[model samples]
Target chain A: MEWLYVLMPIAGVKIFWPGLIILGVGVGIIGGFFGMGGAWMVTPGLNILGFPMAFAIGTDIAHMAGKSLISTMRHGKFGNVDYKLGMIMLIGTVVGFEIGAQMIMWLERLGSVEKVVRYLYVVLLALIAWMVFHDINVKKKKEAKMVAAGGDAKDAVGVEWHKTFHAIKIPPMMHFNEAGIYCSMWLPVFVSFLTGWLAGILGIGGGLIRMPSLIYIVGCPTHVAVGTDLFEVAISGVYGAGTYTYKGRTELVAAVIMLVGASMGAQVGAVATKYIKGYGIRYAFGLAVIGCIVSIVLKLVAKAQNIPILDDASTAVVLATVSSLSLYILLRFIAGCKKELAEIAAKG
Target chain B: MKTRFIKLFSWCLFACLALPEFAHAAAAKVSNIVIVADTRKFSGWEAWWTNLYNESHLYFALLTMALIPTVGVIFGTFADFLMGFIGIDLKSRGDVGH
Candidate 1:
């Protein structure tokens, strides 16, 4: 009975399992398609659901670690992973995580860590949302122009700046068979360092940055980029978790439970991505960023106003956003599968 | 141009390494509670040993957590590939119109 009492709060409302399911589904789909764990969504969702912020962060990282392992393994089998590039990035990632953890410790001393982090989350979310939305819109307009000209829409986006970066001859050049590029090894290391720096500073996986950088700058095929990014995320996530644990800020039980949910969710999400197309992924990614922005806004408002009611409202908004995204991903997966089956029938 | 690019890359790497040292210095001042509870209060060696053990455990925990991400990435990459081979090609599914 005493054990049950201890378990009760951990279980916290019966909705936790459902929440876990929804979180897993959403993250899995996004992660599969984008090669991101969607930790930004996971951490806040857990916090809103009555887990302490530190616990939420720790658990999110832990779950991410487990989920990434599953996803990376799946992706690797497809010949998509660039091990040399991932290893180069790993070096930078570790250094960035240690520094980021130190910054959080400094903030904690001021006793305004929560406020500062929330503010930063809001600002970052807004910025990321804007970038994703802008890119999606630009891509759409470009596709429309291609359609009008009766050309393949994919060619209109052109080679991004990062790909051009690969053409720059630099010393210590490296080749990535999966990426199909021979560029200075330093490029990936530099990108990883920057992404790691951001992840450490923000207390989030830098997958949001990593995925795009791999695709545009690193010139990785979109699928391979997704796989490699997950590899990067897993590496960085572990480092971040270790830093937090060293500070005695990690909640192990919570992290383990979340891991159970996320690992399973990741499998489904990774599988789902096989059916969804590139543009669909881009649009969904845009929507996810927008969802994050809204949730962050709600959290910021609740914190600023000292309104307990606002907290509930923020939680509701987050839950709703996660639910909608999860549904969209699942539906997209089903639709893709159906289309594939229909094609097979037509061929038959 | 090659030399210049190498210089820039090295510069970036050095900057990354330097930033963490500054952050760690700031972190050093923050006092963290070290839990070393025992069923009975003891003196001298037993107490010292207990403290040492607790500290080691904490370090172990940190190491375990940090390893998770790297391992995850390796695994996630493989998972992505497997899915791709299974005829999913997720990023291209929406392009059936072509």
Candidate 2:
């Protein structure tokens, strides 16, 4: 009986296991598919479940790191990982995270840290959603052109920015064989550092920011960008988790349990990428960004209006939207499995 | 086929051994500076890594068996699914498969 008391600390912390389980599953799916762990999903869910905000963030990062590792490994096998690029991005990420932390401390002095951060979060979410929607339309237009030309859509030329960027011949150039690019190493480092800074300041992984930046700014192929993004996430997340824990902000028990679900989800998500074409991934990733944006917007509106009920409603909407998106990813996985079986049978 | 399998297996082994060590060395290099800078308190890097490892180890240890096979099987399955979903079936490819 005493041993049972010792083992079961959940009794002390008023948490709903069911909520955590659901949250983990949703985050895992998104994380696996997009190379972006669902920290946005997990953190808010934990907060709602009665954990302090700091604990929620700490636990989320812990789960995210594990999940990111599993996905990165899987993506690596599929030849999607660009290690050189990821490493270069690491230099930037570390610097950015530190700078972002300093900025937060500075804002804390101004006594408007919370308000500023919240407002920024809302604005960033909206901006990202807009970007994703814009990209989706661009993709559609590209597809239409290919159809009009009677050419295979797969043969469509990619964005020309990569070539343009490569021609700059900046010193200290580096080559990423997997990404099939040679460019200034400083580019990735600078981009990652900026992303890292944002991640540190906002208290979330910069994946939501980094993924798009990698694609549009750094000009990596989408698949490679996704894989590389996970690599960066793993690195930054580990650092974040450690930093928070040392500061006594981490909830060890919650983090461990969440990791259990995240690791499993990441495996499924990572492998599913193999079956999903680049365009499909792009579309889904875009939608995930939109979902996140909507969730953040609802939260902002609730806060601005000072309506407690709206806050509750926003939380529910966030949970529901995230869960549905996650379910969609799982359904995609199952469909993929069936298709593989059919192909094997046909071969026989 | 055997050679290819061997190559992949070796690569996996290398990655497993190498990455953590790389991460550790990087952390170790900064550990002293990080520790001293924050008035002998824990640095951000230390805090982030420790919690991450703690959380990850639990899941990794628990699911090691299921984890390994899932990667290859699920990936292959997904690839087939994608092709079909995109209407790129072998019948459409005419003589390509044969």
Candidate 3:
């Protein structure tokens, strides 16, 4: 294990190469399947592997750009990416993120805003988790009612908020053909702005927030949201990686090693999305949110108590949970792929 | 619950907009984290890279930025080949009609 460590040139640190690859695979599966960057999952893993915090963020973003491109390619093949919608959302995201970053800088002038930001982060995660679970329950209830009324379960209506959004005829409406939506163009723009603002305030890549926003607010199907979000992430990740690298904060060697594992994991995760329904993905995403909440809570507790061991313990817990979840996702992806191929063979 | 969540989310956003001052008043840095590593010094390519980073910062930075995504594309293409071998299609999902 000691001999497996490699030196990071820019960050001037030694990291376990295998640990970085394993961490990449775990995050890759989650990112590919959910269409989010999964930054929260990667940070602790990097920290535990003795990667420098100064470099961790830049290195993570560098790999994320590559990993997301892989996911976007696969999801695009599956008709999961909405490029037109993504472009529109990107406009809003940039402006909103700039404003949000400025706001944070302003707040920092008065005093350190770290705790408030962390609390806000946890709150956001909780809200997202609740929303995903609620959507799942609503779908379940609707399906049950439809079956009871002698209609097919598949006939149950989907989320109604999009209809309300469409009804708001404030301005020019646009059709996102790939996402199967025709609503006020302002809808996606507004939703992306809000998510991006939150992302900026939290200083995180906005995939987790944006994915849910795409699904629930913009009325994108879950699969489309994942793909579109990955598309957005890819672009933003490149910008992030570039800026951080310019600051000499990136460890390119680590990023490259991670990308190798991430590419494979991205394929598995993206392909798995084809076999899972929208609600199924939402349910899994909700669970991942809960896992994140648990990890954050542990870190908060550790900090409040000034216990270093507790902090390490929290990191260990997150690593374990993420590892298991990624493993489960991989297994599911494999099974789903095999099943789909067999069905195709039988039909042929 | 869904309606309540929407309401809460809206309120949270509003709070973020309105209360920038009040939120940071009770701010204390709760965690003091450090990244520890051995400085064994650098030689060979590592030494040259460090010198380049210090001497021509912008060029070194540009090189890293370009190299990362290029590597990503190469790996992505490799994954595409592997997926195709496993009977997976990367061209399209045939969902155009939808």
Task: Return the TM-score for each candidate structure.
Answer: 0.71, 0.74, 0.87
**Reference-based lDDT, each prediction:** 0.63, 0.64, 0.78
Per-candidate interface C-alpha RMSD?
A: 7.5, 11.3, 7.0
Say which prediction, candidate 1 or candidate 2, comes out ahead on TM-score.
Answer: 2
- Which stretch of 10 consecutive residues in model 2 chain A shows the poorest summed lDDT? A3-12
RMSD of 3: 8.3
Candidate 2 local lDDT, A300-327, one digit each (tens): 7788888777677767776876787778
TM-score of chain B of each: 0.39, 0.31, 0.52
Ten contiguous residues with the weakest lDDT in model 2 chain B: B89-98
- Quote the positional error of residue A176 for candidate 2 in Å: 0.8
lDDT of 2 at B49: 41
lDDT of 3 by residue, B20-86 (tens): 3221310121122333322347788777776676666468667776886777778777877877787
Give per-residue CA lDDT, model 1, range B1-98, as digits (tens).
Answer: 99989977985886577545533632453356553335145457545533443567466455556545444445445544554566554443242210
Scoring the B chain of model 2 against the true B chain gives a TM-score of: 0.31
Candidate 1 on A203-242: residue-level lDDT in tens? 6667876776676667776667777888877655555466
Q: Which candidate leads the pack in lDDT? A: 3
Alpha-carbon RMSD, each predicted model: 7.4, 9.4, 8.3
